[model samples]
Target: MLALNKIRPGVNGLAVIEREVREPGPGEMLVRVHAAGVCGTDMQLYHGAGAFAQRLKLPTTLGHEMCGTVIALGPEAATPQGAGRVKVGDLVSLESHIPCWNCNACRTGRAHVCPNTRYPGIDIDGCFAQYITVPTSIAWVNPPGTAPKLAALLEPLGIAVHATLEGRGVSGQTVVVNGCGPIGLMNVAVARHFGARRVIAIDPNAKRRQMALQMGADEALDPTAAPPVQTVRDLTHGELAGVVFEYTGSPDGVRNTFAMVGALGDVRWCATPGQPMDFDFGAWRKSRPTIYNIHGRRLWDTWDVAAPLVYENHIDLQPIASHEIPLADSPRAFALILAGEAIKPLILCE
Candidate 1:
């Protein structure tokens, strides 16, 4: 079977290579890849930025947000506390973070931050191939009739669901999304669906700004065009934003976030700020806003929160995907994302 394996450690190292599919290990299941969503993390790793650059082993298949059907299972594939079980023919989305259930973090109800964690695409072979193996425990079976693209997005959608659901109600509140990348746009849609009064989208890119508007943002601003902080203040009638979703991960975006958000507002961050941010603590002391650094969706808990909305068709995510490419053309897909010409590129792997 062919896989989009990262042949080396730099952006240029990414390429599509062939590999043999191995049988699933004990307590694991073999999933035939269907569709996968490319994320910003993949871009960072491709550029050899962040800690994942050091952790990533070369020549590993690189993707985690994916959907597929189970074709085979290893011995005693799953142990259930309830009725849920892993079986062949189940259509599922995988949990990217694979934790050691025996770790103290896992034992104490913090498995999401397990000490010895192995993340698919980063730490191990991931689902960018015809067949990949994973622990059956992390597979989430979707409700029937879910479309191929929608199933592939469940993993990333859980991110928006987690951030929005975790925050205090956005009902009738003005919200700001300081980036209109895929997840940032998802934040806009989720906020609108959950009932925010006004959702503002911020990004320098015109295309993404347009996407933000389509995804339910009341206003989309180019931070470079208009003095963003002042514009946001004026647009909000001086009330400022009640909640700011920081998705740019740029230091400028971080700096402006504190300015655009109102006193006591919440800044729920979901982007990766590569370097140490020079946070304006002096000005921040006056507002006393609550800050949340969102890690990956709160494990199975977020799945329970997001699955119903997705299955019932409350949130539409099809717009976030700007490019659809074959898995064999992953290098081209990666180039598109890295060049900032695309948002989420949905990859199909048969």
Candidate 2:
């Protein structure tokens, strides 16, 4: 098997190397990966910073957003928790978060925020390889004829869906997506499909702003050219947005998110900054908006809503998958993202 591994610490220490394939362990499944996507978490590992980077054991494969076919299952894979769940020949998209189902959070249906959660790309060998062995509990089986590349996107799309469906929902509200990254752009489309009265997108990147318009944002603003907070306020006729999604993790962007929302509005804080930064609780108190800290998708609950949007063609993800590179040339995908030239790049593993 050929895998993309973080062979060394610090920036850009990735290499594609040949390795012997490992068989699945008890309650696990072996998958032949068809496609994978590079995400923000992978970028943190690439830079050798953040908590995820600190948790990495060197020479680990670095991917979790993927779609693959089941080739084999380990002993007891069909017994206990996974009984009658996944099986050979099923096409599946990974859930990314490997939670300890015995924990309080998992036992009470809050597994997405399980304190003992482990991530594939950061904790164990990941799907950047031709084959990956993962616990069968995390696989979401796709319809037999579903497109593998699009299925690979479902994991991220789940985040957008979860945000859109959070407190107060988007229907009939003036929504603002304060960043135009892959997930943010997905939120723009999702907000529109769920009946948002108006959707506004904000990003400094010209290309992203243009893509936001394509994804159903009524207007896209370049924050660098004009202040997004005032622009959003003016566009809303002084009412401000009813909901604001915070995807830009910068300090300035965070402050602007608070200022852009109307009093008593919902603020879905999706992205995490790499380091600690100052914040003003006084301003937040004055704004009186409720802040929702979004983590990964809400396990099966989110998948149920997200997967259908893609499978039924209710939202178009084609534009977000801006580039595709072969598995051997996967490093270039990271380069494209770093250069701000690609939205979401798919690695063709098959």
lDDT winner among the candidates?
A: 2
RMSD of 2: 0.8
What lDDT would each prediction earn against the true structure?
Answer: 0.85, 0.94
**TM-score for all models, in order of appearance:** 0.96, 0.99
Among all candidates shown, the one with the greatest TM-score: 2
Scanning candidate 2 in windows of ten residues, the lowest lDDT window is: 75-84
In every candidate, how many clashes are there? 0, 0
Model 1 vs truth, CA RMSD: 1.6
- Model 1: residues with Cα > 4 Å off, grouped in runs: 80-84
**lDDT, residue 8, model 1:** 81
Superposed on all Cα atoms, the candidates' RMSDs to the truth, in angstroms, are 1.6, 0.8
In angstroms, give how far residue 165 of model 1 lies from its true place.
1.5
Per-residue lDDT of 1-350 in model 1, one digit per residue for the tens? 98998788766687788898889887888999899988877877788878987888787888899999999998767545113387789898988888887878888777777878888888878888888888887898986677877888888888888888766858889999898888888889989999999999999998899999999999999989878899989988898999998888888888888888899999988888888777878898989889987777776888887777778878888888788899888788888876888989988998
Residue 343 local lDDT, model 1: 83
The CA lDDT at 336 in model 2 is 98
lDDT of 1 at 179: 88
Relative to the true structure, candidate 2 reaches a TM of 0.99
